[model samples]
Target: MGQNTNIRGIVQAAVAMTTVGTLTAVSATVSRYPVYGGQAVRYAVAAVILLGVARLRGPRPGPSARWEWPLLAALAATGLAGFNVCIVEGTRYTSPATIGTVVGSVPVVLAVAAPLMEGRRPAARIVAAAAVVTAGAALANGLGGGSLPGLLLALGALAGEVCFSLLALPLLPRLGAVRVSAYSAAAAVPMLLAAGLAVDGTSVLRVPTRGEVAGLGYLSLVVTAGAFIVWYDALGRIGADRAGLFAGLIPVSAVATTMVLGLRSPGMAELGGALLVGLGVIVGLRRSAERPLAVAAPADHHDPAHDEEGHQDQAHDDQHPEDRRFVAEKAADHGV
Candidate 1:
């Protein structure tokens, strides 16, 4: 099971890299489109796609409590709206490479925050790997000139990236990955629209060009709707600390996209950074030989048909009470 989880994490990480990398490349077209306007369109379309997916998937496979709404809203606000706004607004003042370098520290942020949030220090090797990933991000992005405002905006983006996964952990057992993703995207639409109106004025209401529309579609459907589901699913399976390290691949993927698009060939720094990010992923994903997972009790002690579902339940139960409360609240709805 651990091996399978690691494999899934690797696949999910690849998907995430592809998602953000495509965003980096596609965003070049948005130079003509107002940033906020582009984001508003992206989330709106994403919400629509997610809503359809939610409907098709039927009701979530478990009971739910209304209390999960606030967490979902926060996830939408920070991860979807605030994060994109920071990147877009930040880019106006600084280069995308600068933004990428700042955002690349997401694993480090998660590693540090894990102790505060979960009351356990991350593995030393994991923290070291995260640092290596951060260094790779800087090198791959070729850290260069940036203003104070741009740096601050990039920090805001970093905050959003951290919040996205951390915020989802508490709700994973209750809502399931797809539903959590769907709800967040749906909730973010209004937030993004209001932000777009504030930032871009009447321009937000204008029809986008065909090229902009293409970019918007890809961002909405592929990056948001598709990537969010995969990311949260992997987070549930493998845990966030290990999964977050994979985020380092975003810069590498960006370099790959550039090479494919013939924008520019990667230099020594990019190649070396890509290798470091790969090494970090390998080191971070390795399970400790001395600290094997506790063996589960006999099947007779659990529901025979529910063995698969039990793992996810145990994952949630291992969290802090604050993290477990959402599940407890929803379990109460089922009288469990």
Candidate 2:
């Protein structure tokens, strides 16, 4: 069951990143739209769809604590809205390759941070694999020069990307992936709209052209809504350290997307980078030779199978004491 869960997580994470990669092709169509306003609409639509799906899936709890609200807002502000804004503005001062190379280091950051955050030592195998993945991603993107401001913005984006997964961990056990996705996406809309009004003025919103509409539709429906759920679900199943390795697939998928669109063909470096990404992921996912100690959950903390939307109950039961304490305290504060 554990192996099966990991496989599902790998596949889901891969699909989610690949879907995000396809955005490179569609983003051009919406390039002329007001960045903040368009993203507001995109996330708004995604929130609605995710909420609907969550409803259909059956009733579940939401963030009940005041702190949880802020956490979700932070996730939206940093990960969703702020990340997009940084990418848009960063491109003005830097090559996309520069930003891509910087953001591509997310795996290494997560591999190290996620374990530490969970009160465990970072797995050597995963950290080494993450380095391999980052190197490959950098090679695929091709290191490029950027201004100081652009470098900073790219770093900001990297932080946002890391937070996108890590922040969701505390919420996942109770809220599940769908609710967290829905709530965070919903939280982002107002923030983006406010930014739009500030940055783009009253002209922030206008009816999009037909092509832009199509592009927004795809982004809202597939890239934002579907991918967010899948990514979060995978994170819950595999843990962030393991799931982070699949981020290397983003550049690989982007290259493949470009090839499919006949926009460009893969060069030797790109092909080699893709191989490294595959190899790194394989290495990271392998069972460690020394299994870490698993802290037993409190007897009273029984989780129904449906509560976490198919999250492996055994996995939750085996969480480190620190993890359980964190969740328990949060749940108590939330009146859950």
Candidate 3:
């Protein structure tokens, strides 16, 4: 059952990232549209779809603590709005490949940072695999020259990508994936709209051309709403470090998308990079007999410490939930 869950998570993460990669193709259609305003509209549409899905899925817990709200806001502000802004501005001063190569380092960041944040040592095997993934992603993207400003903006985008997953780890236990995706998408709309107003002025919300509308629809329904849920759900199942490995697929998928569109044919370098990405993901996801599960209980499992009424024992709430879950899973694995 555990192995099956991990496999499902892997599939989910791969599909989500691949879908995101196709955004490279779709983005051209909306390239002329005002970035902030277009993104605002895209996210607003996504928010509605996600909210509708969440409602149909039945009642789940909402944010109880004040701190979760801020985290969610940060997730929207930095991960969604700021990330797009960085990419748009960065490309003005640098090649897209330059920015992409910089952001390609996400696997390594997540491999090290996720474990450390949970107060565990990073797994040596996973760290090595992450390095391979990053290299593969860079090769796939190819290096390009960029101004210092573009490099800095790329770094900012990288930070945003990392925060998108890490910030949601704590919230998954309570709110699940759908609500978090919905709330963040909803929250991002206002931020993007405000930026649009300040930047694009009265022209911010003009009617989009048919092609632009189609692009926005794809970005909203598939990339934002669908991918967000799958990615977050994968994070819950596989943990961030494992799921992060799939991010390497982004560039590989982008290459494939272009090939299919007949925009470009990938050379030997791109093909080789795709092979490396597969290799890295396979190596990173291998289960170690000696290493412990990152999260103690399966995300779907009811918290043994919490009752049906959703009341938690004081002790459980005081300690970091990840640590507690780790302890619980460890005990179960050992037949304690």
Candidate 4:
């Protein structure tokens, strides 16, 4: 089971890297459509596909009380809307390489933030792996010139990603990944549409070329639909911190894609970075594999050590209900 989980995590990482890597290739099609409008379409189509799949393969959508709607809306705003807009707009003022370097640090942020927010020290290996990944991403992108506005916008994208992972981790237990992803995408449609109107207005309504339409379909079906489902599935299976580390593979994959397309060959530095990313992933998996599995006992079965741990965890949750809830849910999901 542990081996299978690790393999699945690797697969998820590969999927995410491919999804982001394809973005560069699709830029020509993306340019043909209004940024916000194109994103709105991509997300809307993905939402419909996910919703349809959910209706067929899963239970009804109701998970909790009405209060969750606000959280869902927030996910839509930040994860779906803000992430896309920030990256798109940021590139206008800065190079894509700069944006890649900035956004690649998200895994490192999650590695640090996960432990602190949960009131525990992060494992040394996880931190080390994150650092290696971050270094690899920087090497892949290089320390190039970038404007202040572009840097800030790149940070916004990073922030949006942090919110997406941190916020969605807890909610996965309640709503499950498919439902949460669908709801978030559905909710973001209006926001994207509104932004599109405010920015490009009727230009968004213009007919797109065949290549552009195909690109939108790829974004909707493959990147958003396939990528998100696999991403959250990995999150649920392996936990968010480990899943986040997989993001370091983005630059590596992007470089590989570039090479495949004969756009440009990777120099020694890029090759070295790719090796580092692969090494980082291996280190991350080692950390994950080192974690002892939790075997849950029946409620009636009383073991002093387990009971004490449970009480301590409960007390921790009581002290900080919001942040600790994610830890609790993640534990429960793992049957810890």
RMSD per candidate (Å) reads 6.6, 5.7, 5.0, 7.4
Q: Would you give me the overall lDDT of model 2?
A: 0.85
- The number of the candidate with the highest lDDT is 3
Better of 2 and 3 by TM-score: 3
lDDT of 4 by residue, 1-336 (tens): 255665765687568766876777666666867888888888899999998987876454464666677888888898889988898889889998888889889879988886566456676787788888888877887645589999999999989888887777656655666788888899999998888888898776567788888989998998888887777777655556667777887777777877887888888888888778778867876733334211111121233235555676654533434436657787999999
Q: Best-fitting candidate, measured by TM-score?
A: 3
Which whole-number lDDT from 0 to 100 does residue 215 have in model 3? 93
Give the per-residue lDDT digits (tens) of candidate 2, residues 1-336.
Answer: 255666777788899988988887778789999988999999999999999988997766668777788899899999998898889889999999999999999999999999889776788999999999998998888778889999999999999999999898888767778889999999999998988998899988999999999999999999999999888888866778888998998888888988998898999999999989989999988865444222222111224454445346666666555666767888899999
TM-score of each: 0.84, 0.88, 0.88, 0.83
Residue 38's lDDT within candidate 3 is 92
lDDT of 1 at 336: 100
Clashing residue pairs, backbone N/CA/C < 3 A, model 1:
none
Over 286-325, each residue of candidate 3 has an lDDT whose tens digit, in order, gives 8675353334223334443463453455436534556577
Stretches of model 4 off by over 4 angstroms after superposition? 61-65, 287-290, 293-336
* Predicted structure 2, TM vs. truth: 0.88
Error of 4 at 77 (Å): 1.1
The global C-alpha lDDT for each of the candidates, from Candidate 1 onward, is 0.76, 0.85, 0.86, 0.75
Off by over 4 Å in 2: 292-336
lDDT at residue 229 of model 4 (Cα atoms): 79
